[model samples]
Target: MKFQLDEQQGGNAISRHDGQCVWVNGQPHRASLLVPWRGEVQPWPLSRFEDLTEAHFEQILACKPELVVFGSGARIRFARPQLYRSLIQARIGVETMDLGAACRTYNVLASEGRAVLAALLIDPE
Candidate 1:
């Protein structure tokens, strides 16, 4: 007998992750990327979490997701709330976590059919 997992049914899932890279759908992605639950994974120019600004957040907001899962590099980091003021105004939710944790959370949320976007900032080894 076989059990079918929710994430295996055509939804994008994080297949693996490590200190230097993350694998989405079994492909290794070394740089930062924006992974939407139902669309393409786009490259995010900002390499580090500290480089995040209002403009960066605005670009993610343009994707029109109900919530954003922010993977703040190798270790958990918090951003200034003012930087994401537009999201708050738009009533979009943002959750911060380390890259590994964020990846796991994104898989679960996407499997549940939530309109979520994982904004991951990968740090170099």
Candidate 2:
């Protein structure tokens, strides 16, 4: 689906997304990636929800966002809390949803100037 956020001065926004890929700032990406509000976009190195691990969450922590909008491919899937205990203990919130929803919500939160990260996984298929 075509997704967009009001072009803010900084922060990455998803311009489009399909189950297999997402366009960040109009650049198409088939692999998982991390888009932090007002920061550089980086590869997340994940293809599916099952591939998630503590290391991935730690990577998100490195971005230092107040919240993470996790896009679990084309379906809504919740990661085990233990996978993100560090974020919880750090008081950073995580909201899990499908890629489409995450993209849309990320746009809204990001536009509001919230410190947010979009942890999106594109289906390997």
Candidate 3:
């Protein structure tokens, strides 16, 4: 599905549903669906992260965010150097932290209206 972002609500604004997956803007996202997102919980119908490709990164780049946060599941040092370099070359800052910290940081920056995109991974059970 197509995902449309609600720019006015900011990052704290998340769409939530009961059993159905949450859609961010209009596109189905699974960033928060795989776990309990404490902030603005939303339904993301997508099943896997592999579906998120370089095109997704390009779209996010359009946001002209100051920083991009990647939540690599529960691991602290699982960052993709190539992706990180790409963002840096575009003048965007990148941070690879655990999912929990990434969520908290994303909310804070999002609320502040900072251009920040969070690519969070699901915690393995």
The lDDT leader among the candidates is: 2
TM-score of each: 0.91, 0.92, 0.55
What is the full ranking by lDDT, best candidate first? 2, 1, 3
Model 2 lDDT-worst window of ten: 2-11
Global CA lDDT computed for model 1: 0.88
- Candidate 1: count the clashes: 0
TM-score, predicted candidate 3 vs. hidden true structure: 0.55
Best by TM-score: 2
The C-alpha stretches of model 1 lying farther than 4 A from their native spots are 1-7
2 versus 3: better lDDT goes to? 2
- In angstroms, the error of model 1 at 101 is 0.5
**What is the lDDT, from 0 to 100, of the residue 1 in candidate 2?**
75
Evaluation by lDDT, superior candidate among 1 and 3: 1
| Candidate 1 lDDT tens digits, 20-103 | 788988889999999989778888888877788999899899999999999998889999999999999999999999999999
Clashing pairs in 2: 11-38
lDDT of each: 0.88, 0.88, 0.52
Q: Write the per-residue lDDT of candidate 3 for residues 5-78, one digit (tens) a residue.
A: 44536334334322223344345554444212123333333334445455445554555667877665555654
